[model samples]
Target: MMYFAPYIDASGLHIPSYTDVRDQLLSDARSIFGQDIYLESDSQDYQWISVVANIVYDSFLTSQAVYNARGPSTAIGSALDIIVKINGIKRLPAAYSTCYVTLTGSVGTIITGGVVADINGYEWTLTTPISIGSSGQATALATCKSPGPITANVGEINKITTPTFGWTAVTNPGTAVTGAYAETDAQLRSRQAISTAQSSQTVLEGVKGAIAAVSGVQRSVVYENDKNVTDANGLPPHSISAVVEGGSDDAIAQAIYNKKGLGCYTNGNVPVQITDLYGVAAVIRFSRPAYVDIDVTINLKQLSGYTTQTTTDIKSAIVAFINSLTIGDSLTLSSLWGAALSANSVPNKPTFSITGVTAARHGQPLGTIDIAIAYNEVTRGNVANIVVNVS
Candidate 1:
C-alpha cells in the first residue's frame, strides 16, 4: 500500500516528493503517544513517483488532467538526425562548399562540368576525379566534400584552357578524339560554372530550415518560460504562468478551452503546443562540410484558467480543453537555404501521433482518456505524481 500527503501554496498546487509528507505522517502518529520513541514506514513509501499513474481527488479544486501520452520513443540519438530524416529531404551539393570540381588532365583530356543537381548519396566519395576529354570523363566519379585547400589529382582532366580545346589523348591531339571531346568550346565551361553556383545555393536553403526547426523545439520543452525576450526592448522579465486549481468544471474547463480553443466542431479537447523536433533522428554534425544546416521550431504554451473548483471538475475541463484547439497556431516554416526540389525529390515535414492520455489531480483517476494528434512533439509524455493532504 502507498501513503498520501500534500501541502498547499498560494496561487497553485506545488507537490514535492513523498519524503516530506511521509515523515510528517509518521510524526503525527508518534505525537499521539506521550512517550513517543519511533515510528514505522514501508519500502513502497520510499519513492516519490507512483507505481501506477493516478489523479488527485480533492473537492476544493475540480480535477483537470495534467497528464499526456506520447507513445513510443523514436530511437533517434541527436538533434541533427531528427531534422534530416523526418523534417525534410533535400539535395546536397556535388561536393562541399565548392560548386566546381577540379579538372586534372592526364597529359591530354578535357573536363566537363555536367549539369545535374542530385545523384545517389553513396555515389559521391572524396576526391573522385573530374575530367576534360572523353577518356577523362569515363573515370568521372564525383569528388564530394574534401578537407582544406587540396587539389584533386583527377589524372587527365586538367584546367580549362583559354580557347577551350576538349583534348583527348591523341594518338594525335587534332582530330583523333571524339567530336564532343576534340572540339571543346570556351562558352560551355563558363556557363557550367554559373549553373553549379546557383544549385549549391538552393541546397543550403533546405539545410538552414532544418537547423532552425530543431533549435526551436529544444527551446520549447526545456526553455520553460519564454516571456517578452523576443521584443522586450530591455524590459523586466514578464510572466508566463498557468493557474490549475480545484476550480469547478464550469469555469475551469471553459477558461482553458477559450484560450487554447481550436477545431472544436466535435468533442472538447484541450489545446497543446506542438514543435518539430527534427534533429532527433538523422544527421550527424561534422565540424565542417560542403553545406550548412539551419533548423526551426514552433513553440506553444497554454495561458488560460478559472479560479474556483474541485479535482473532479478539472478532469472534465481537461477533455474540453483539448477539443477547442485548432492546428494553424504554429511558426510558419520557411525555405531557408536549399537546392530546389528536383523532378525526383520532395520535402518531408514533421509528422506526429499522440495516442494516449492519463489524468490525476488529488490522488484518484477521473478515468483513462485516449487522444490522437497529428504531431507527437507537442507535450511531455511523463508527468510527476500528485502529492495531496488535507488541503
Candidate 2:
C-alpha cells in the first residue's frame, strides 16, 4: 500500500492525510543533511534543554532577609518599604514554543527558570513584570535560540539495509597524490569529472530501480550526467562518486506539482514501464553518464478501458465524453486540442492513467501557468499548465 496521499478538504486546504506528516519528515531530513552536520552511520544523538523566565520589581529586596539585620520575619512588613506592586502572572503549560508578552520585558533576565526539555517537546516557565511606582518597567519574557549540536544527517535515501544500487567510491588514477593520478590542472579536473560521473551512475540506477517498482508507469531518461576527456581519449571513471540527493552536486532537479488538478511531474529520470494491469509491472532504464547519451523509454498502456465515445465532430463529442468523467476543469487545457482527424474511444479504464509527469525545478519555481479548463480526450486528451494566472 502507498504510505500516504495528499488530499484537499473544505477546511481551507487541509492536508488531511499522512502525506503531510511524511513530507514534513522528508523536509526535516533535507534541512538536517544539506548542511555541515557531520554524521556517523548508524548512530543516534539525544539532548535535553531547559528554559525559564520571570518578572519582578525590586528583586534586590527579594534577596535573603538574612543579608541585612532584617530576618525573613522582618521582610513581611517593614513600613511597606516603598510600596512594591506584584506584577502580572503568566502561566506556561509545561513547555510550548510561541508566546506573547503583555508588557515589554527581557526573557533572558529578571524572569527565570528551566527544565529538562526535548526539541519536539519541552518544559518552560514564563514571568510577567509590572511597573513599580514609575521606577519599574512593565515587561514580558520571550525565548531565543541557543547554539549547540543540531545538525544531523541520516544515511542516503533508498539506502535501506544495503539497497542494490547507490554511489560507489573512487580514487584518482594519477601517481602524484595517494588518490591523485596526475599533477596537471587538466588531470585534476579530469579526476573530479570522472568521480562525479561514477556517483551519478549509482544514483541514476537507484532511481531507475525505484521507478521500476511502481506499477502502471514507465521510466526513461532524457539526459544523463556526462564526462568527456579533453585533448585525449581516456576511459572515464568506472564508479559513480556523488549525486546531489538534494542539490549543489549537479544540475538541480526540476519538478512541478499541481494539487488543484491532475498532478504532472517531469525529471530527466523516468520510471520503468508497466505492462500488466492485473499483475505488477514496471519500467526502468540503466544509464551511464560518462558519455553524451543514455537511452530512456517510458509508456503507460491501458490494460482496460473506462468509457466509450465515438464522435463525428471531435470537439462536441469529446466534450460530452469528458463531461462524463469525474474531474474538474478549473484548469484550461495545456494546449488547445489540435484536432486529430480520427476519433477513438477507450473502455474499462482505471481511475487515472497517468501518462507522464515532469518534476518541478528542485528549488525554484521556474515558471507557472494556470489553466482554467476541463478536458477529456478521444483523439487527444486535455492537458493543463501553470500559466500567468487562471483568472
Candidate 3:
C-alpha cells in the first residue's frame, strides 16, 4: 500500500506512481481466470495469488527506484556516490582563514615562533620569530592556527597572549577572511556538470571552473586584460586577475596552471608560482577576500509572548543570515532587518537599526556605517557581539 517508486506512464514521456501495480496484476488475473474461480470465494488459493502479485509489484517498484537512482538530480545520487565518481569531481573540504597580525610589546621585547595569541579564545600562531625595536613591534603578520571559518573575523582578535617575553598587544590590520566548508552536493554538481561538458579544451571559463573545484574555495572571479592595455591597477596587458575566497593559494595556483591558456599571464598582489609536470612554471596571482563585520542592534519591548529564550534565538537567526552571504555579495538594510524580525520570538515591527558597518581593516575600521559592501568583501556577524535589548 505504501509505494515509493515511479513508473512510465502510457504517454511514455512521463513517470508516475506505480501505486496500482499490484491491483493491475490482480485485475488481469481476475479478467483471465474469471471472478467465479477466485473472487466468488474467500479461498486460500486466492490469498496465495494475491500474495504473489504483491511480491511481483514490490519487485517492479524496486526496479523503478533503481532506474531513478542513476540520475544525478535525484536523491540517490549522493547516496550512491555517483555524482562525484562519474563526473571526476570530489567535494571540497572545509578550510580556515589566514591573515597577518601585528604584535606589539616593550621596545626591547622579542616574540619567537610558536608563540600563541588569541581573540575570543581562537588562537593565531606566529610562524616566525620577531623582535621589538624602537617601534615596539615584533611581528606584523600572524597565521591562524584554527582550522575552521570561526576565526575568519577581522579586527576582532586583538589581544595578545602566551607571548615569548614582554609582548604586550596583538592586532590584525587586514580582515581574516576566506574560511569555508566543503561544497555541498548541489554546488558540486553545478561545477561538475559544467566542467565535464567542457572537458575537451581548457578555456577561461574552464580555468574558473577548475579553481572553483578546489577544496575550500567558496567563490571566485576571473578578470582578463587581453588587450594588453595596462589598466589603472597597473596590470600588464594580457594578464589575468583572479579574486578568490576560501582555498589554499598553492591549490588555486595549481588549478590555474592546469587550465589557463598558454602564454596568458596572471596578475595580482600575491603570486603563487607552480611548476607543471614538465617543469614549466606558472604564476597565478590572487587576493583573499576581506571580511566586513556587520554590527546590528535590535530594540524590542517585552510583551506577553516574549520568553527568556527569545533573545538567544534572535541572535542565532542573525548569525545564520550573516553566514549565508557569500563573497562579492551585498546585503541591503531591509534584508537584514527582516532577518532579525523573522526570529521566532521577535514580535512584529520590532525597532531596529544598522548601528554600524565596520571594515575589518589593518589599523582601523574604514568607511561609514553604510549598508553597502565592496565586491571583494564578505560580511560576518558574531552572536556575542550582537546587541539585543528588551524593555
Candidate 4:
C-alpha cells in the first residue's frame, strides 16, 4: 500500500490529501490494536484518530506553504516582499498627486505656503514658494493633501484657497500627474524581472533596465535607430529614444547618461542637463509618454443572479484591462470580451453574456477595429468612458 506522506522531490513539495492522511491513520491503528480492533465513526478511538489526522494534514500544508515562499515567482504578500529585496528593490509606497498651477498676481509679489482648491474641493498644497515675476504670473507645483491617484484637470484648479497678499488667482494649465497606490505583487514582480537586466550584455537592454529602476518611474520603453539615416519615428541616426512615464527629470537624465554607450545620441522632447563627477555637463533628452484616451462600450444580456452591481463590476473590469496595456500596446477588440466576462463571480453559470464589445479613441465613434497606439503613447481609461447596456 502506498503511504501518504509529505515529500519533496524534483517537482518541489507534494502534499497529500486529507482523506489519504485519515485513511493511513486508521490503517496504522488497525495494525497497532490488532486486525479485529473495534473502531468506527461513533467510537472514541476513531474520533481521536480523525483529530490527529487533521492536525498532521495541516502541518503538511504549512510545510508546503513555507517551501513555496522561498521562490520569488510563487511567493506572495510579505514573502514576496522579502524576496524582491534580493534585487535591491523595495515595494513602492503610495504617492500623492501633483500639478502645476499658474498664479496671476501683482508683479514682484511673494507668496509662501499657499493652497489651491480644485473644483472637487480637494486642497492641493504648493510645494514651493511662488513669486510673481515681471510677466504678472508665476507657476508653482502643488501636491494634493490626500494621496493615491488624485487628479485635477486643466482650469479645474482655479480657486485660491489660501489667500495671500497680492496673490489674486490660480489655475492649472495642464492636467495633474495622478499619483499611484502601493505597488501590487504583480507590478512588483514584473519590475523585479526588469531590474535584473541592469547588467545585461546588450547596451540597449542595460539602458532600458537602468531607466526602469529609477524611483517613481511607472513605465518605460527604449527604442534604437541603428541605421545611418533617421528612422520613421523621427529618431536620429544612431540614437536611442526613451519614452518614460513618471519619475523626476533629473533622475531620469542621470540614469540614461550612466548606461548609454559612449557618444550615443539621446532623443526626446524634454532635455535635462547632467553633470558628471568631473564637472562635465551633458544634455540628455527623453520623452514622456503621451496619453491616448480610450472609450469602451459593453453590451450584455443579463442572466439569473445579475444585479446592478454586476454591471458596475463589468465596467470596472473593462476599464482596468484598458489601463493595464503598456506603452505602444494596441487595444484589441476581441480581448475586451474576456475582460468583460471575468467580472462574473456567480457559480455554475455566468451572470451575463456579452452580446457585443467595441472600443475607440475618446470622442470618436466606437468600432470593432483595434486601435493603433504610437510607440510613445499609452492608453488611458476612465470608468465614465465605459458604457454597459444590459437587457
> After superposing candidate 3, which stretches have Cα over 4 Å from the reference?
1-82, 94-148, 152-178, 181-186, 189-202, 225-238, 276-282, 299-305, 345-370
How do the residues 211-291 of candidate 3 rate in per-residue lDDT, one tens digit apiece? 777766666777677885786645579977777776688998888777778788877676888877889776677766666
Residue pairs in candidate 4 whose N, alpha carbon or C atoms collide under 3 angstroms? none
**Model 3 worst lDDT run, 10 consecutive residues:** 353-362
| Candidate 1 TM-score over all chains jointly | 0.18
Question: Taking the tens digit of each residue's C-alpha lDDT, what string does model 4 give over 49-135?
Answer: 889989998998888888989977878889999998998887888888889889999999988889889887889999666789999
Top model by TM-score, which number?
Answer: 4
| Per-model TM values vs. the true structure | 0.18, 0.14, 0.58, 0.81
Q: Please provide, for model 2 over 1-391, each residue's C-alpha lDDT reduced to its tens digit, 9 standing for 90 to 100.
A: 2323333356322222233343344445558776454333333421100000011112322343323323221323332121111111111112112222222223222322311122222222234322212322232232212221111111111111111122111111211100111122222222223323322445444443332222211111222324433212121322121111111111122111100012212222323343345675433222212111101111223234322222223333323223222212232222222121122243333322324212121223432343222221111111111111100
Over all chains combined, what TM-score does candidate 3 have? 0.58
Model 4 worst lDDT window (10 residues): 1-10
Question: How does residue 27 of candidate 2 score in lDDT?
Answer: 46
Residue 301 C-alpha lDDT in model 2: 33
Q: Provide the overall lDDT of each model, using Cα atoms, as 2-decimal numbers.
A: 0.25, 0.24, 0.64, 0.87
- Model 1 ranges with Cα > 4 A deviation: 1-15, 18-66, 69-100, 103-391
Estimate, for each residue in 47-69, the C-alpha lDDT of model 1 and write its tens digit.
32222122223321231112101
- The pairs that clash in candidate 3 are 101-142, 173-361, 173-362, 228-237
Tell me model 2's lDDT, rounded to 2 decimals.
0.24
Model 4, residue 43: distance off in Å is 11
TM-score, cand. 2: 0.14
